[model samples]
Target chain A: MNSTKGEKIFYGINYFVLLLIGLTCVLPLVHVLAMSFSDKHAIASGAVSLWPVNFDSSGYSALFDETPIFKAFRNSLIITVVGTALNVLFTVLAAYPLSKRYFIGRRFYSLAVVFTMLFTAGLIPNYLLLKSLGLLNSYGALWLPGLVSVWNLMILRSFFEGLPEELEEAARIDGSSEWRLLSQIILPLSGPVIAAISLFYGVTHWNAFMNVLIYINDTNRQNLTVLVQQLIQNQSFMQEMANTQPEMAAKLTPEGVKAAGVIVMTLPMLVLYPFLQKYFVKGAMIGAVKG
Target chain B: MSKALPPPASAITNPSQEQARTRSNWLVRKYGKRVLKQNVPLYLMFLPIMIFFLVFKYYPMTGLVIAFKKYSFLKGIWGSPSAGLHSFQMIFNNDQMIKIIWNTFKLSGLSILIGFPLPIILALLLNEVRKMIFKRFIQTFVYLPHFLNWVIVGGIVVTVFSQNETGVINHVVKWLTGSTFPFLYNETSWTSIFIASGVWKEAGWSAIIYLAALTTIDQSLYEAASIDGANKWQQTIRITIPAIMPTVIIMLILKIGHLMELGFDQVFVLQNDAVSNVAEVISTFMYKIGIQQANFSLATAMGLFESIVGLVLVLTANSIARRFGQGLW
Candidate 1:
């Protein structure tokens, strides 16, 4: 385990390069975070540097008070919780039977999932379908296509296969049926995989704006991501229309507010990251590496 | 209604235990009962997902007919007349059709080719680092940009590459040479900025998978190669790269499946009228043309075409992977 002079030099160079690359990723976030805290006047005057200069809580206060930003927060929570529930439920149900190597019609069922993954009907068909089902502006629309994420199903399926058959066999011998065995025995051992899928679904649902934009046009049903988008939309449109708060409107920098919204929107997930990441990446790699 | 109209349930409905026995028999006869009866909890677990997909995914899948029809807001889906492929032609005649298709190919292909492999290379380098803390630091830092919102990333890109004299890229250009490079405006440079920014944001996070694959690359092989006097370069080229090749190939095959996707959120936020010609990718185009303009039929046709192409590419890629003995399945 000894390094020669050349090996040591090479190692030193490699570390420096990685350090530089790492800095590049971290620094921009610092810039945005700093900007989010800086006062509107200072931000507009270009006084804000990499760190905030002339710091103020006005932007944060205004964001929380004047806007439906909090309402959006509540909406995002609903969609994420409900959507993640659906995602995990459907993915596990579909994946469980399909994961069984001996399950009848397994290939056909799996092929159906694969078919959905490969070929989508696209926006128009999906939109019309939602309209026909009268799902427009409903919470269900937010979680529809998202339910049964094909990737999650695949990951959970892989996790299920990794479980030893003997565990299920023991339950079967006690007169428990396959359904009970999966629930009481199999699913109990699936904590990590479940956590990982739940996090994945949660993030996707939390970050979802496009589907909401397409399906639910009503402002009342808009989620946080869509609401942030509305802030962006308002900033651009405010000058054209009369500013709601004419006094503050002149000094309002959409740049900082938009930056604040990004932080607000992604911060919850960021906090959730360390807690779930150990499982999320492992679940992902289990499928990515092994498959 | 039956209970209201008929005599109370106390009459004859379920008064007899024999009636209950017959009802149980009927239920058993109607549906083959007790097949994995214990797994009802598992079925219960899947209930929400099944309902959601049934409503959202499968229903939308069946709703694909809107692509083939002149979707009338009044007449509704069933009453609408099918276009007999004319909607596809309307999409083709949009004048910007070729540009949209070209941008999609360029963006997706670039992201797939260079963006795809850089992660593997970075992973290989990091895997060889040997220092645990350093490896973790590299991972934590690089993975961050991937989690960042595209809006923030787009702002950062604009700030650095602003077309103005004080812009960072402009400043660098004026100082080093003599003129400004229109990073956003110039069509030729737009694709590179988009793809490079994409790579910067994702390369580290993406590399995590390759790194995972590398971890499984039997450590004994490396020990054997080192004992034979293989240098770091030789060992990486001969053993490590080959070990991770299957994962790399399988990832490549999957990337092929998403050839038409073009990262809608990223493109939608980053693009502007200045760079519209080059930056107007299919996904963004669909949003504008379909959603914004409300030309439902044309947009649907375009969306349908993209999906078909994507589907065909994925099928072909999966088959090829199957042939080569590698795929996610």
Candidate 2:
């Protein structure tokens, strides 16, 4: 428990390096936040850095105005909520049965699931299958293919396996049905793992961009990430829009608008994160140890 | 409990032993049927998940045959004529194929080289911290970037490294050296930026495992080492590093297994016309030719190639790890 002066210096250097690394991770996002609220002239002149030179809310208001960004945000919310729901439901259902020692064909089913983690039919064939299934251009394309993540399933299964067997046996002896056992006994005791897996699924669903880009041809149905990509690619046009639209010219700058878009898209996860941060860490550790 | 118990031993030796044997045989058959029947509810619950995996996960695997076929919209996957190796031949014959493959490997290799050890180092340094509040704060801050999707991270990368006057890093470089570097445009700077951003995003998240492993190392070993007049550096090199070596090796193998996939999301978001040559990895290339250009067969062939290589690498890595006593399986 005691350290010499040399060890004290080593610990000092360690804290210093870690603090620097941590700042590198956070400072850019902080800069983005400052830019999102900076005045148009301040943004244009590159005066904003870690803080707003001249404070304004125009960029955020511009986002709220009749923009495709808002619609995309709504679509993203819908998909994340529904997709995460299905993900947890399917993973739990499949994991619970497979966790049982006496479940018939458990080995076969477990292998079938684990095989997916090792190989996948690449994007082309997956796209083709979805096209044939009439899921293309639909939200189903976004949600259906990823309904059950094999990694999350394995984590949940490991958690389920760690549960005491005597509870289930006792429930069965009391004439409780399988549904009752799962709903009343197993699930009640599984709050932390469930929360952890749900956070993983929620984050995956929220960040979906490739599926939206590839399968959904309809811009109306596209999510915030796709919209953000379009905004980034069309930076010139966005700047031009600021010049042409008098109201926007008064209120917004292109850089500030882009920063606002980034903030809006990122804010949900950041907001939800602190409350469930421990669960996220727990989920990652579970995946590392078990997966 | 007594009611559920079997009869006493004297009853089993009587003339009813014959009847008891037949009855027990019947009971065995009945028990087997009941066990099978008892599984019905569980099977029903699992039915929907099984159907989902079959349709989405397993069925698309069968569609990999489209790589070997002259796939057409009207003919469908099954009805399409077998092109055999024609599509693969086209892929191999193309000059861009080599460039794409090389790009995938070079980028991924560089990332793994630089990015792989960072988390271990971070975890080691973080382990030295005595203040819980400070450690937790640093952990939270560093882990924040991993939660942001590549789209946002890519945007931050572009913003920070923008060639314009406003770019934060460019401004600093100009201030220091009197000239700005085109970090995202030039091939060299682009690669560096790409790898750096990857490290920034994932290193902390990856460190969680190492930190967890560190906690499992017995505390008494360090105390013993200190008692023997060993310093912190000596203890780390002698005890801490060796303790986490298996985890480090397993993680390295897993990283190597995905060498073909230079993260499509990260590459696609960061890619532009200027850096296309160095940035166009296999996944992005496949997306362009297969999804954007609608060259289904060729794209499928390219995808199959990537998948096969990935499979081989994973199996090879797993075997190697097993030989080293650190295999994932």
Candidate 3:
């Protein structure tokens, strides 16, 4: 609690450096926000920095009018919601059985699961396998392959294992099935872990990119990540957008539209940012402590 | 994915063994049948997961045989003819492949060199902060980019570093120096931007683990050290660093394990036509060759090589860590 003069200087430098670092992290996003809201002419003239020069919502209006950003948003939502539900379900089913001390061949099963994390089939084989299964170009391609995340399953397994065994014994004495015991007793006590794992899966699904790029052939099926990436990377896509909305071509710039697309794609994360920070730190701590 | 270590194997006596030891039919019927009946639901619960692993994970692993085969789409995985080591031979013979592999190693090595230690330093610095509100604000901002997918981050990077008037940095540079620098277009600058952006994105998120490690440290140790006339610097070096060395080592080992996988999405998004020479890595190369061009055999061979090297690296790193008495297993 006591600070020397040297300690005081160190603290001063520390705060200044940290404040600078924090600003570096946030100022770019702020810049993009400003660019997204700035007039096309102002953005073209490079007048925008951390604040908008001529505040306008026309970039977003143009983005919505010309691009399939709304479709991408809906697809992202479906994948995140449905994928997280399946993730939680499969994670629970697998974790419950593995948690039991008396379960047969549990070590073999756990090792089988964990080994996948160590070395995977990589992209080509996984893609080929998906192709063979007729899962390509469908949302099933996205969800089915990563149905039960090994990491989440491991966390949930530990959580389930840590639950009071007396509850299970008590349920067994009353002729409750293992299913009923898991649903009624184990899950009710695992709200925190489940919530954390859901957020984990939810974020992954929301950010789904490479898989969508590989498996989903239909542009209509693409999620916001891929769609935003298209708008950013593909100059031709911007050209196509301009052609689609020729009336607004003079009023729209690629920079403004791209920045708007970035914001739109990130809007959900921005909304969820507070909850994400709280739970994700908790989730990381749980994994580290129990890992 | 999951970092949860396997729990110590339970040594409960097997009910089947007990049933075998008993000569009486009644005991066998009671113990064996009841055990089987009770566990039926559990086995049932585990069945679908097993199927998923078999079909999606294990089956694809087996399908890696295409790496050694002349794969044909119509002929399928099973119908393809064996090419033995031809695909791997092609990989070694190709100059571009060599460059890509080197690029993968160089990028990842540079990333680890630059990106690895910052989080530890950031964590230590954050630990010294006296103001909770200030600490929270810094953390919130720093962790913001991690929540964003690479697409958004990549878009921001491109926008900020673009060569033209829209680029914020270039605009500032142009005003100051009367010339705009090519941050993304030039190879040297692109590499710098790549590594810097990676640090910017992940350094804060990675610090959380170190902060968590720091929390378990005893305050009395610091109190006693300060009472003994040790300065804050001396306290950190003598007390805090030693305290978190195991964590540092473990994190280092895990990081080394992922040396081969530089992550495709970030590179794919950040890379431009002008800088692809330095930017192309194994994953992106595989995407172009295998997925886009349908050169399945060659791409699979490359993928197989990456996976094997990664597995070897992890094992080697773990073994090295074991010598320091900090095996991940």
Candidate 4:
């Protein structure tokens, strides 16, 4: 596999261009991290960019002191954990039966699921539905409406269809019922697809804010995303806080606190991203191609 | 549901038509009962998902009737008075309608034009890379932004493009031109910023599909092209491009189908009062009118309009794709 001089030059240029594009993605994140650690006075003075200037931990400390922020963080955690579990359970149950060739009304059930991907009830009806159900302002408001994602269902169904039918037949011959076959035989063989879909559901739940904003009026029930959005968008909130607590203003500038909030909210995803990268790529490719 | 059940097996197998007619009735009943009894477990496993979809998805579809009604909270959806296209008329006659529609089209059109091609080009470039680790590293970095929600990205956008001296782009512009640009507020700059951020956020993730498509391309084609004295650029243009054309067309059709959406989260977070003229899109507008103002009918009307346009676009695009031999179905 010897390459020509021209091919060598093309490869060189490709490497350089890709490295530059990669940095464009990373630098802004680095800048945010730098600003989050910089002193409030230095941040206000517009000195920080790529690195911390007059470094301090006041912003982080201030965020830690805010009970509402912790509550929001806990809320996001609960929603993500419980929500992802429900999503995985529903998706597996639906996909397994639908994937079976002998399952009655498989086509009808699949079409019903796939229809939701193309069309939605929009926001108002969804909100009204939750409100009428007395689920608003509760944890159910966060995850109940989205208990089963159609896109995930399609992906999981495709994965299940790809599995060997002989394995299921063997389990059935061993007197395993449909439920036992799914739990004891099929599920254990479905680790990769399940992991990938679980990550998708987890990320969606963790990053959900629109549903929270519409349904949860109570502050304690809100997620980190909504809190971070409010903190970043409402610069006036910091000013109002300064007016009320003059001394506290010196320790936390709006920009510094906002950068801190962004970091805290985004850190979990970033940490989990590396470990999940391969599964994410595999799952996404499976989805894009088959979907 | 009963109508969906298959006819009796004896109906198809019977040799004598006259005898078949008489026996079919009894066989149909027996077959239906037998099938039901046999597949009960499968249906039981499927019941929860069916119930979920019925409650959340189909139920809300029925609620679309609110678009035609006054939508009083006191008098529920059924009890509300029929408005008879009042909301539709209100939306069409509104002064902001033209600007909102124009802005939505402009933003989505520009995004499709620019955002669609970058991923293909990036995938092509990455394909040219000889080293696997370097290619993987580039992909890892690029795919990072796709995982982040708009709120965090919006925060970063605000930080980088703020009018204040602390804003990174403004800081550099001030140093270079002795003046600062209002990236978020001005119409032209705001739209550019929106598209630019969109490209930044999705270009890497979108490239994954193209890259996957690229892998399916036979290496023999490239070797054949090379033997024909086709250079890298020529092979790319002639062979590589054609190999992935079906995928490219399918993705483009899907993107066009979602033209009206414009991503509610991205647009909502990036939008501000100052840039409302260029920034207000159909989804955000619907949210404001429907949720914020409690003008349920108008909001629902707007949503219905958006959905109808979306359905028409997808159907048209899918049909067009089929005509070109690359239909999604």
Candidate 5:
């Protein structure tokens, strides 16, 4: 074969391998999605295939009907929004100065940040500290601890370093102060890195459950991830198996409901992915390296 | 000291520019004394973050004392009676303590051992594909699981392997051999399920860094190998693997440092009465014995113990990396 045809043959094989890998990643998701929409009887009987059988919106309808789920969703939104805002604000301010090699205390600050990353203060200290601060049973418990991420800070710092000196120099010529230059010049030009970091911060905030579970006891204050865990625990969807057919009330397995719960929480991220897919892979890689 | 901060560029050429920068440097060098005298507004923006870190991040260090105390909320951390070494003894004395430690090491260490190499392999496999559309599609699919909450991952696992007619794995086995296999209900399959689920969720997302590293490799090496009649596998093993070895080692050291936390989210979800003995990691153990039981002192003690062990592992990993000429420091 000629070079082009030979390359074509190789490309075809690569595509086939990649396609199979993609399916391996995707099939499980489809399987769950299919089951979640199926009627409880259809699911319990294993009548469903790769798609929903007897197509029922009962799972979703019942989910929306519950007051706690909606309230939890609201709590999650609040935490994600406020937490991400704080995260972006603190991480950027902290990282900007750290990126400047000429800045005083740079080494000390880097040491402190990296030390925290490598050695987590352990769960007890963190919990006790929060309890002592009277932040227990509060949403502030979630937002405050995660206000600035060392990993994200390092990435933002690297981006700040890569900025052209001439831009800042030009701003300085016009009598712009450091703060002014950062806000007006550096930030405006650093949109990609900012967006990349923001997406990461947002996702982390949205998906966070463990800290909320530890710090907040009030069900009203719990975030979506916590709420979802609660819902799955109650095995509420398993009721569908018992509800429609009394014969299977005892047989109502947790399998389908768990799948539905995973599908429910995972839906938000999966829905958000397509919109932000391009940046995520790039952001992950860029953030992986040190500043 | 009272003079303006000099611009770096003008100082490159103009003597007057050099003079202004010197004046700025002197002002800063004076312990910010001159700058404070000039402007105090700079303090406002940084105050919140400093306080946040101090109160939430650093203040927690005080709780480390509970590790040394017969902790009581009534008497408080300082006033709490000092058992000193007793709680440490309690943990060490527990019949299952060694087993817990061993289980933790097995899960985390083996996860690291197996998990570290797969991403590089996936990335290499991915990089060989020249088609941009196909590459992007595969990446998007893989990265989706990384964003999921562990609660959801656990739920997914249960859904896949639940001992029921509707469970995915059981259904398939029932179809194939006319009998269902109860994967989740069986304790023997729990750890494997945990690790496999972990791999399934993370493999694609984790490959991004390796893919990035692969991009920076010299393409000309591949070209030369191709011309010499070497196939893609040979070029990949000979060239791609060596090129990304630094990133791999650094990532490995990072993974090794985290040899204590087998991801609380993953374990907390997968854990139950049947498999809690095997799956009860340090985090889960703390959550149960300390947090749920509300034994603040004992919890703090266990937390401190875990931290010490984790610290030692990380320090060891860092030092070993240094010895390997691939240390993160």
Candidate 6:
């Protein structure tokens, strides 16, 4: 436990360097937050760095009142909630049968699922398929194609397989149906794994972008992630924002509006981050166990 | 306690046994009607999942055949006339093809080269820390960016690197050098920005796996090494790296396997007209041609090419890793 002088110096440099790297990861986000609350004149004069200069709430007021960001936020919530529900449901259904030792066609079914992970139809064909199926511009386009992620399915299935067979066997002896067995005996026992996979699904749905961009052409259906990107990068969208509220645009700078939009999109994740931090580390570590 | 335990999942899932069971379906039927009755709910639960895979996954896989067809919306996937090798020919013959392919490789190669080792190094440094609170605090900030989607990360990149007055890095650069660099517009700067942002977003999240691996190394070994006069550096070189080498190789192989996927979101969001030559990866190129321009066949061909290369790389990587007893499969 005793550290030599040389080791002490080494540890000192290591800690300092790590702290710098960690700060690099976080400071940009802090800068963005600072810009969101700073005055337009202060932001314009490049006075904002990591703290608000001439603090104002106008940018957020402008973001909520002058833009469709609220609608986009609602859309994100709907997609994430509904999408995660379906994902967890399908993942459990798929994993349960695959986990059963004597389930007919289980091996065949498992391989069939795993094969999709090894190869996929890629973006173009998947897009074409969605279009042909009348799913384009619908939330189904986002939800249906990724009904169950193979990676999450594997994680849950492995967890299910590891459960003691005695519980299921005893349930069956009581004339309990497979559905009841899963709902009562199996699911309650698998809360940690379910929570982990649910977090995985929830995070992916909340951050849904590429599918939304490719599938949903309607601006109203777009989620917060895409909306924030448009606010930040789309020049014409900025024009539309200004045109929508000339007085507000004049008052709030585009950079301030963009920063506000970014914060709005990121706030939920930040709020839930402590819980996500705890669960996801466990989830990823579970992945290290060979499935 | 008297109840006989069923076979474990690994035992039942052996490929040979599965094949044998398929060959003897009579055995499946011997327990059939009663078994089927008992398992009806299981089958019912599984039916929708099968339908999802069939309609979404396999059906789109079948749709990849459009790569060879002169696909027309009116004619439909089946009704379209066969174009033989025409679509692939266009992909190969076009001058932009080589550049696009090279750009994809150069970007992904640089990403793996710079991005792969970082997390391992970070994990080692974190492990060296005696204070648990400091290590956890550093991890919290480090892993934070990975949760943000690529769009948010891209926005951050643009914000920090923009040549305008608001851009943080450029403002500093201008103060020092008296001129601003167009980080997102110029090809060279764009590539650097792209790779740097990628590392920033992912390195900490990636380090979690290595940290997990590090935890499995027995503490006794470290204690023994220290007792033998092996300094911290010597212990890490001899014992620590050796224990985690398998995980490292497996992760490396997986990274190489995904060389073709340059992440469509990152490239699409950050790229502009000025940097298109260097940033135009296959996924973005396919999206523009297939979705925007409706050049479905050509784009499908390009996708097929990417997937096939991805498959080959994974298999090659797995086999190589097998030599070291660390294959994923």
Model 6 bad stretches (over 4 Å): A240-245, B1-25, B28-40
Poorest 10 consecutive residues by lDDT, candidate 4 chain B: B30-39
Off by over 4 Å in 3: A241-244, B1-37
TM-score of chain B of each: 0.87, 0.89, 0.89, 0.89, 0.85, 0.89
Estimate how well candidate 2 is docked, as a DockQ score: 0.66
The per-residue C-alpha lDDT of model 4 at residue A150 equals: 80
Q: Write the residue-wise lDDT of candidate 3 on B1-329 in tens digits.
A: 67987665543545666655664566446557667677789999999999999998998998899999999988998899999999999999999899999999999999999999999999999999999999999999998888888999899999999889889889999999999998898999999999998999999999988998999999999889988999888999999999988889888888888999999999999998999999999999999999999999999999999999999999999999899898988
Identify the runs in model 2 with alpha carbons over 4 angstroms from their true place.
A236-244, B1-31
**lDDT of every model, 2 decimals:** 0.76, 0.88, 0.90, 0.87, 0.77, 0.88
Candidates arranged by DockQ, highest first? 3, 4, 2, 6, 5, 1
Each prediction's TM-score versus the true structure: 0.87, 0.93, 0.93, 0.93, 0.89, 0.93
Q: What is the DockQ of each candidate?
A: 0.34, 0.66, 0.75, 0.70, 0.50, 0.63
Going through the candidates in order, what fraction of the true interface contacts does each contain? 0.50, 0.70, 0.84, 0.66, 0.59, 0.70
Q: Which digits, one per residue and each the tens of the lDDT, describe model 4 over residues A173-244?
A: 798888888899889998998999999999999999788888888988899999999988887767766787
Candidate 2 lDDT by residue in tens digits, A244-280: 7777656776677778889999998888878889999
TM-score of 4: 0.93
Interface RMSD (Å) of candidate 5: 2.5
Candidate 3 lDDT over A101-156, as tens digits, reads 76767899999998998899998889988887889999999999999998888888
| Candidates 3 and 5, the one with greater DockQ | 3
Which one is best on lDDT?
3
lDDT of 3 at B128: 94
Q: Could you tell which candidate, 5 or 6, scores higher by lDDT?
A: 6
lDDT (0-100) at residue B15 of candidate 6?
94
Tens digit per residue, CA lDDT, model 4, B1-329: 66787889967877787686667666557557655554778788888988999999999988899999999999988899999999888878887976787788889999999999999999999999888999999999999999999999999999888898878788889999999888899989998999999999999999999999999988998899899999999999999999889889989988998898888889988999999988999888877778889989888888888778887898899999999889987
RMSD of each: 8.5, 7.6, 6.4, 4.7, 7.5, 7.1
